[model samples]
Target chain A: MKLSIENLNSFYGSVQVLRELTLHVNTGEVLCLLGRNGAGKTTILKSIMGLVEHNGSIMLGDCEISGLGAHEIPRKGIGYVPQGRRLFAELTVKENLQIGMLIKGEDSHSLDRIFKLFPVLKERLKQESGTLSGGEQQMLAMARALCLQPGVLLLDEPTEGLMPSMIASIRDVVLKLREQGVGILLVEQRIDAVLPVANRVAFIENGYVKAEMERDELANEPDLMRHYVGI
Target chain B: MDFGPFLFLATLEGLVQAAVLCLIALGLSLVFGVMRVVNVAHGEFYMLGAVLAWWITGWFAGNPAIGFVAAIIIGPLLVGVIAYFVERLILRKVEYDPEATIVATIGILYIVQQLVLITFGPDARPVDTPFYFLIEFPWFGYSGYKLLVICAAIMLLLAVWYVITRTRLGLVMRATQYDRETAQNFGIAVNQVYAIVFATGAGLAAVAAVLIVPIQQAHYLMGRDPLLLSFIVVIIGGLGSIRGTLVAALIIGLSDGIISVFFSPTLAKMVSTLLVAMVLVFKPEGLFGSRSQL
Candidate 1:
């Protein structure tokens, strides 16, 4: 599966956030979006998820999903894990996962696979998600999205305030998902942690893609990364 | 009248009032709980149900039971259909905004009242009880149908509890109540859920009206008192808590019945209103309601 975007423009009320932004993610690859705060990295993901109004087309493997409602985007094979780990705080961990299954009509057997991925969730299936720790909530969010079994996953700052050990665990989960051939569009500010998992890095500034570097090129050229991302 | 028989009668009356109030306030509570939209026209839906019951019974020449049965089933269904349209057309247009929906519902209250007055006429009408058998108490006989209303209310409340606890639809509603954006992202159609919740809430109120129209005459303006009482029940019970609504309904209903029987009906209303004010001043979250995040 591939997600291709061309000339995407988004706005919040009258202020423009994303201006003619273009990017793509192929199956079995992880594309990381790196940028400063208020740089429109999250807006691009929101635009793809149909959460925000946008002008350009978002093609998810031949189908244009830009005009679809936010709820319809997930059914069209695009899963989204929004910023702040927007879990249903009052709902149980299991019920939160069940919401995704209800939409896609997937069976309970897939839950076993998810539980294997996040064993802590299995033990706390009946517990309310709001009571969980930050790392646990992040795991629940990712697991909830994965329950959709989408072709492409959009993650916005999955490890924003996690501890070091929790960050490593999240990084490992992303790498494992990559091995399973789920194309991932990850937005992150922590370059050191995301560098190991990213297949290619896209530096965005002012809602535009400033530079694109392959993994080998990023490893070889530290000055180029500093020049574009200002890291 | 002897005090013993009078006390028994008052308790029975209280139970009936509690049953009806539970049904009405449950609808209000569920709507507030899920959608956070205060339906100002909720009482009109009840009045519509009663008016519809009177109309449906008018068609049958004999056997008031047939009319009663048909009204109980058809009243709620018709109100549910009307509510579905109202939500999709009016409430949905307002984006379910708290203040906007309140104004829209108040407009709906007047519209429904005027429509009923014009079509159903301005007279208050009574529905005959389905059965005439009376329950023989030790001192006096009591209406068997009133007792049946209490039993039916218990069964219906149990059914509602089961649906909320065991059904997938309930899970979807709870998830939506917790976080609408996340629920939408997970592929739950939030708009569709809102429409369904709105319809169901109206239907529940209609059911209460159908059950009570036999005792209380159906009038175009009768919705006013029930609306006031239901708001009081919801407020004292906690705005959006179903369990709180039920408990508060019982407390208000029983006290109203006993006080009305012992003293004056006006005193009952005054005392309940005072209690509501006290609850608001002290524990705004209500006796049973937890502090809501939203």
Candidate 2:
């Protein structure tokens, strides 16, 4: 399945945050969205997931999912983690995961999969999710998105503000999702951390993709990397 | 004079009143704990419960004993079913908006109260206590029926505690209260939980009304006093805390009991209100509240 976003634009009341952005991710591929803060990266992801009102064409495979509500979007083969790990804080880790599965309308072995990848969650399954470290919460957030077993998974800043080791763990989790043959559209502020795992990268500026690159060829484009990523 | 006997009577009466207060207010607190709506018309559900009990007893007037018990149990069940559908049809649709909920539920309260008056007539109906033997106990002269109400209320509290602390449904309810979106993400059917919680709350209010009606006769205005007192208890106890609600109920109940024993019932109510006002001013978290946030 390919998650294709074309001419996508979103607004916060009168102010337009996302403007005519286009990007796509094929099955079993991780497509990273790169942009500085306030560059409309999160807006694009939120719009696609129907958390914000937007004008655009969002196609999951051949199906147009732009008009669907946030809750309905997951049922149509797209899962969203949302920003800030918008988890139920008072609930236990297991309950948080269970809520994601409940929405899927399918009974998958999500519990086994979550524990298999993040064994720490298994030990802390009964503990309140809010008490978990930010990295653990992020892992549960990602695991919750995956529990839906979507054909297309859209994540916004899955590894933001984490310790170096925790960031690497999340990056590893993204790679593992790719290995499981899932299509991923990852929005990130840290370009370098995601580019290595991402098969393709798009640099978004002013709600538009200013540049797109294949990860393997990015090494030779020193000027493009320096200008776009500011690294 | 004889302070021991008066104090003993007040203690017994206060405990019984507290038990009923806790039962009804717990439901109010539970609904507030999750939905954040005051459910202004919650009192009307209690009214409906008493009216249903009266209606059922009238239906089975052959043997007053059988009629009374059946009416008490069935009253709340009937009201619970009605409340379930009412929530789905009306409250659930507008649960997100608090202002809208207040207006709508207040509207529902008037509609329900008027309906009861029309059906049962304007006069307050007398519900006979099923048990006639005035169980005479040392230090307190009380009817066995009143003791029965207190015991049933305590048992209900225990059952509620078990359901909340020992069951999966209880966890979901608590989780839903603290954060709704998260509960939905975890695959918990939030709407189902809301319906069940709302019905249980309604049933509880219904039971509370029927239990106390024998001591304090049933009237169209029955919902008023309980509603006012329970709100005070819930406020002083802290919203959404069961332990807090129970504690607050006892405090208000005992104060009212003692005041009415020595002073007037009106004075007791005034004193209780004054106490609640002080709590809200100083320790808004209540006697046993864990946190300020809901």
Candidate 3:
């Protein structure tokens, strides 16, 4: 399903973080949000997940999801893997996965797919999540969200501190999700990682969408990143 | 008169105290751990359970055992329902803000205490034990009912442990305790979880009171000691650590029983308070809690 946001203004208390930013991700396409720190890229994802106060139309295939409670939003076929992984640290890997599956509301046989993607998670199922390595934790985070089998997935900085090999695997997973027809909105700092997976790049500056371009066109222009993202 | 019998008696009394205190403190610790709010009225829920047990048992004039059995089953359930409303109305309204909830629960404490004093007539009422069989020891006779209380507490603790470790509902609670926002993101009804947890906490406190009312009189002010002791247990055990709570309860309960029996009740309270101060000074996160948890 298509996910669309129009005239979305989000705020944290009195500090307005997102302006009238408009964006959308079509089915089976990965829309990457590229921006510097304090550019409100993360806020955009939070607003769509109804985790922040916002005034906007967040339409998931014409169903407005803005103003919904955070607990209610995930049940609408959207899975969010927030920054820092945010796993229940004390809980075991199996229990962490169980929380995600609880949202799916049924045993949808997604565990097999998850295990196939991250075999290490199956090995460490009984191990505490906090004890997992950073890469394993990220994989578990992605695997936890994937348990939802969501129509749209919002990932915030999934490759923030990963090794190059792990980043490549993340890219492969993103591409695979796109192939499975899951619309993805990925927030990333590395252009190299975004290039292969993101179909379209939405350049955000100061809570506003400054520019949008096809991934190929953006890859061709090196100065565009220097201008909008300052990298 | 020998030291062996006295020590054995003290140990037995301590075990009984630890059994009931663990149940009460577990509730307090769970509520504090998950909701991040100090339930100042936790003791009042305990008092209410004892008072309710007395009131409910007064109905069956023929056999006190029949009423005692009914009190054991119904007392905590009623307290849980009341606690559910209190959480939804007062705690939820305050947004579970730590400071606000403390004030709100203090208000709940006074309201409940005063209401009990007015209706229950400020008397230290007693409930009959479910059974009156005594276990004859070498030197003295011990109440079989007290031993039963210890067994019941163990069983309840085991059930609670099983639920938290092996059940989906328990996983949901732990997830909420870890990160409320993330839990909500996973479609866990966080507010509902808060209500359930708060009620369950109060229910546990009430159960402790119901079990102990047979031994101790149900006084409006009876909540004070259990409240203080359980708080000590929760803090000493490490705020949210259930394992720590149980261990701390045994230590505190046995010490209280032995000290009160040997020296004086006031001295026992002072010693426990001193221990709390020492724990706070030495280990702020508590004995079992990690530094990061604080």
Give the runs in model 1 whose Cα sits over 4 Å from its true position.
A219-230, B1-5, B291-294
Candidate 1 local Cα displacement, residue A148, angstroms: 0.5
The CAPRI-style docking tier of model 3 reads: medium
TM-score of 1: 0.96
Report chain B TM per candidate: 0.98, 0.94, 0.97
RMSD of 3: 1.5
**Winner by TM-score:** 3
Tell me the number of clashing residue pairs for each predicted model.
0, 9, 0
Candidate 2 lDDT tens digits, A1-231: 788989888999888888888888999999888767788888887787676889989999889989865556677777788789887786778777766676554354666877787888888889988899999999888887878887778889888778889989888888888998889999887776787799998887778799898888778888766776676
Q: lDDT by residue for model 1 over B168-222, one digit each (tens)?
A: 9888888787778778787889999998988998999999999998999999998
Model 3, stretches more than 4 Å misplaced?
A105-108, B291-294
Structure candidate 2, residue pairs in collision: A98-B186, A98-B187, A99-B185, A99-B186, A99-B187, A100-B185, A100-B186, A100-B187, A102-B187
Best by lDDT: 3
Cα RMSD, each candidate? 1.8, 3.2, 1.5
Error of 1 at B115 (Å): 0.6
lDDT per residue (tens digit) for residues A5-32 in model 3: 9999999999999999899999999999
Candidate 1 vs candidate 2, TM-score winner:
1
lDDT of each: 0.89, 0.81, 0.91
Candidate 1's error at A170, in angstroms? 1.3
Docking class of 1: medium
Q: For each candidate, report its DockQ versus the true two-chain complex.
A: 0.68, 0.34, 0.79
Q: Is candidate 1 or candidate 3 better by TM-score?
A: 3
